[model samples]
Target chain A: MSSYNWAPGFIDDGDRAQIVTSRFQYEDGHTLDRYLATGGYAGLKAALARTPTQVHEEVKAATLLGRGGAGFPAGTKWGLCPEGKWPRYLVVNGDESEPGTYKDRLLMERDPHQLIEGCLITCYAVGLSQCFLYVRGEMALAQERVAAALNEAYAAGYIGRNILGSKFSVDIVLHWGAGAYVVGEETALIESLEGNRGMPRLKPPFFPAAIGLYGKPTIVNNVETLANLPWLLTHSAAEYMAIGTPTSPGTRMIAVSGHVRRPGVFEIINGTTTFRDLLYGDEFCQGIRDDNELKAFVPGGGSAPWFLPDQLDLPFEAKLVGAAGSMLGSGAVMVMDETTDIPVAALTLARFYAHESCGKCVPCREGATWLERIMERLVDGHGTENDLDQLLEIGQTICPGPFPHAASERLGLAAVPFPFKMTTICFVGPSAYTPVHSAVTLFRSEFEARIVKRKLIPVSIGASDE
Target chain B: MTRLNDANQVLAREIIGRYPKARSATIPLLHVAQQQNGYITQEAIAHIAELVGATSAEVLGTCTFYEMFKMHPVGKYLINICTTMSCALMGAEQLVTHAEQRLGIKAGGTTPDGLFTLERVECQAACTEAPCLQANYRYRYRVNAAQLDQFLDDLAEGQLDAEIPAHGVVARVRQSIPVDRAVSVVAPDDVHEAPVWMPLSGTTA
Candidate 1:
């Protein structure tokens, strides 16, 4: 979307079924004229023709899952809004600050009208009057484009009062965040929307659908999640459901980063596409960079645990990935080459969580910082075998129980599947420990070697010349 | 150091009017305050508090929670080189080291000339272009050592002045929604009945 020189395979190929990124290749793609010329607001028009309840039913039938990390079905989330709550709101989460994730930023920047159209359809279906488009602050282009698009849509009568003579009227407001990753969480997003510190409220009593922005019923959706509505409404639910695997239908945009020959964002088949296809397929990354063998890869975003080469053939399904002890969160697959130092990589991720921990919960704030400190000491060659145990112990304090990890089987620890038990308020606590757990358990020898050296180890991860 | 001037105050008032509650404009108003000053000042915080009907302490509380809202002043050109895992895996650390030596300042330090400020940041979501950096939140991708030097040289020479703005200037365009254009701004307490589509209580689906 930033016109980076990297060529994604799907962009050139005509065979691929790209729903969200169909208009990405064209110049002036973000403009309303291009959007209208290329069948942009047809979904909203079609949605306006049907009853709001009927539109809701159609999306429910499609079973569209939230693409912003958690795989919660969007339709199910919409129904959770109280039946009689008036002036309900729809909040679109564009706060895509995850380490390996950049697809949502592209969605907001390249095809903002598609997202706006999606928001219109969603607000119409869910009986909501106002929608907030909360984008991350760092994305200057995305904010400008979306704000410009909103002005266009308002002028064109696509947004605002009584759209095209339909009785439904909606107001779409664009709000941007100052810089926080934990705000990506729904409740935290709601809090930030209310001009408070971006902290996750305790659930049950504080669900967004029940008590949301300004203490009214609200539906917070991701940019991609709402972006799917345009396509899903344009076609039948059955037709939408037929593209990918039954459970995980529709194409997913995966931002493949780290050591790869052709690293870029690719829209692959949802559940059927495997890590092998993504990392090595000719239509995808082509292969690892510089003919290097793959060492490990982060299946989801930075929060996901590391996956070994043996699990490369597993499908990109949520349930399947979760069964393997990591969730395909945020669709950010980071490929690590054989040259990668596992401890250093883990520390990098640990420091990210430490810096991002909002300090709302003690475990995430204190435990994550301590984890980074220990990992930093270990990577700097001043650690001992005891420090490795201390890392796990600190991780245990965040996520309770015999934590199931990437190397749990080899470590003789119980390999219980994910939805890992947590002691903190949100997943940010466990996310800090994910890297430490996966790296230490899977590559204990590397960490041990660093500890034994007792001297600063020269990092030789990647060559810039390549 | 001064409060929002007449021009910025008009922009600030327009922003506060968009939200149903004035408190929701705190973040956006802070952005305006930052853009007016290089960084958010105590005077700007007090002005935003008066504008948004929140106390200065409350406004400061919200501003401090976010990383982007700098409490102290930064250099004219703030260079945030992302050294997180994905970026680090692609030689982001080496780039940071290169920048530190070249700029003669560590990650969180600004140059003595006050032209450049360097900081090791987390993910900026440009992972595919590994080892990316943001100069005033405008992205520079796949930066090698030479390109970094060229960028710095270009910045110092004012060659890239038109392309990139100062630290707090995120976007030049401000979002404006006219009063007539707004669908409805009825407060939550005033609304009682659900939409025609939503079934009322004790009614079948």
Candidate 2:
């Protein structure tokens, strides 16, 4: 079996759970014992011994960033959590439901004990006596594994009252949310946990860290984010920060799929690795298939902007990708090789976002379906010269600016225009426009060929022969 | 058969109590019904709806919306082949073909012997092990046509044992018994002890 070398700054000597791929080596039956033997609950024990502020400072010093697409600073988010709220809840968003994102699924299913350890540490840091894992409902096995691990933890007295002989009492609840892409959002996940529809909520006073989950303060972190907490607690914040760049710290679990030789999840230190090293790893990926020319890549799952071949060397950073007019929404890299029809792929993606749109907002509900129809027409060789411009125009109208619409538009009524009174309503609506816009921008000739003088262009190379 | 014993009723009631409204309890109720009946039947749906105080339409709609809630009767074991993009690129079609050949039933159908139900679904999020299948909610990843055959044989011969290995584990492993299959009978050696994690008070976690 081929093994890739660990990237520089990777903690190679710690427990198996801290290592990227070694974490899940244990089976479900032995996970709890193995985890316990490896100082899994040591962080929680240590934190219970210290004050919540001490735990928070240790995490903040580590400079850990959220691994659930957003890459927000985990410690800062936790620090912003409101104080004086007793029984604060810590929710670990385990709804790894992104289409191309599977890293969390592997972690939750294979090494659930590690996640439990991370959650316990986080709960202690945030003064939360109760923490709930909102696992994706589709992940039935993962749910079972985590549920089993929680039982083991409780029986061992690592969880429940007086954990590890400390006065700090913490309980971990494993709850599953009905499968939905939007539920991955923190607020939507909270709603789903409360037995409501999975829908994103408007922000401001309702930020989950302050007022969340039964109107109590809650700290919601991603699976990978919480999974890193145990490591941060063991290692000092400065030591943990020594690995990644100044802004982004710790390792990121990148799930690369589509048209790759060895498609799987990999743990790479933030800022130490580039897109090229991830895609063209000597044995893995094996470069683009069929020696076909590279087309575009959805750098961050389906929501991020598409990157051309020239941009493959770009660093995987949120700000950098944003500078390139693409947000690294999720570190799910989807590579599309040559010979694949870009328009068709965009249409398929558009249809998905359209169908899955919560229909709460006008732009997302109406705009996604509209983009899908236009892309279908374009791919079917019925596009006109004006259609290309129309698609771009529509994209601007939906996702208009570089950033997604304000949180209000995402949660409020569709008629509520962009925060700036611009065209698009929310990120989903504008995000739906990304693939279609990229397809048109990159393959204008192909689209133009389809539009014949007055009729739909024929469905042939260069030009639609219809 | 264990029959609808008090333990089963208590489990059912506990699941119902999780939901604030009875109508929202449809899926959990269906899970309980499926646990008892093996496969959900129309009668089971009606019974669940009656228990949950929901209309047949509400129950049916809830069942159809989620992939886990099976509307029709399935074989003794259900093989959910993930046809999502990740699984598709990983040769999920070949896996489905292998399953069909082994069971003599196509996707979304059950075999004549009522031992297996084969179906395709969206991503189960086990993309790392491409071409993965969920044999009754327990993932069997890195599967191909031949692996599917061996798995079916193992299940048929009752050689399947669900043993969760210890940590630091490598090797593509398969669990023979479906998770739901063991839900009815509490195995004597079950690693998980119930009520240990169950909260004693009304406080929500």
Which pairs of residues collide in candidate 1? none
Complex DockQ per candidate: 0.60, 0.15
Writing each residue's lDDT as its tens digit, candidate 1 over A1-466 gives 3243422222334267778888888757899999999998999989988877788889889989999888888888888887666778899999998889988888887899999999999888888878999999988888988999999989888888878877778889999899999999999999898898899998666468888888888998999989989999899899889989889999899989999998878888899999998889887788999999999999999999888886788898988877777889999999999999899999999999999999988989999999999999899988887898999999989988866555344455544478878888888999999999999888889988887644667777777655
Q: Residue A316 deviation, candidate 2, in Å? A: 2.2
TM-score of each: 0.95, 0.76
Writing each residue's lDDT as its tens digit, candidate 2 over B57-137 gives 766655654445555567767778876555665577678887787778779888888778788765566654667776766
- Please write out the lDDT profile of model 1 over residues B63-82, one tens digit for every residue: 99998999888999999999
Q: All models: lDDT?
A: 0.87, 0.63
Looking at candidate 1, what is the lDDT of residue A156?
86
TM-score, model 2 to reference = 0.76
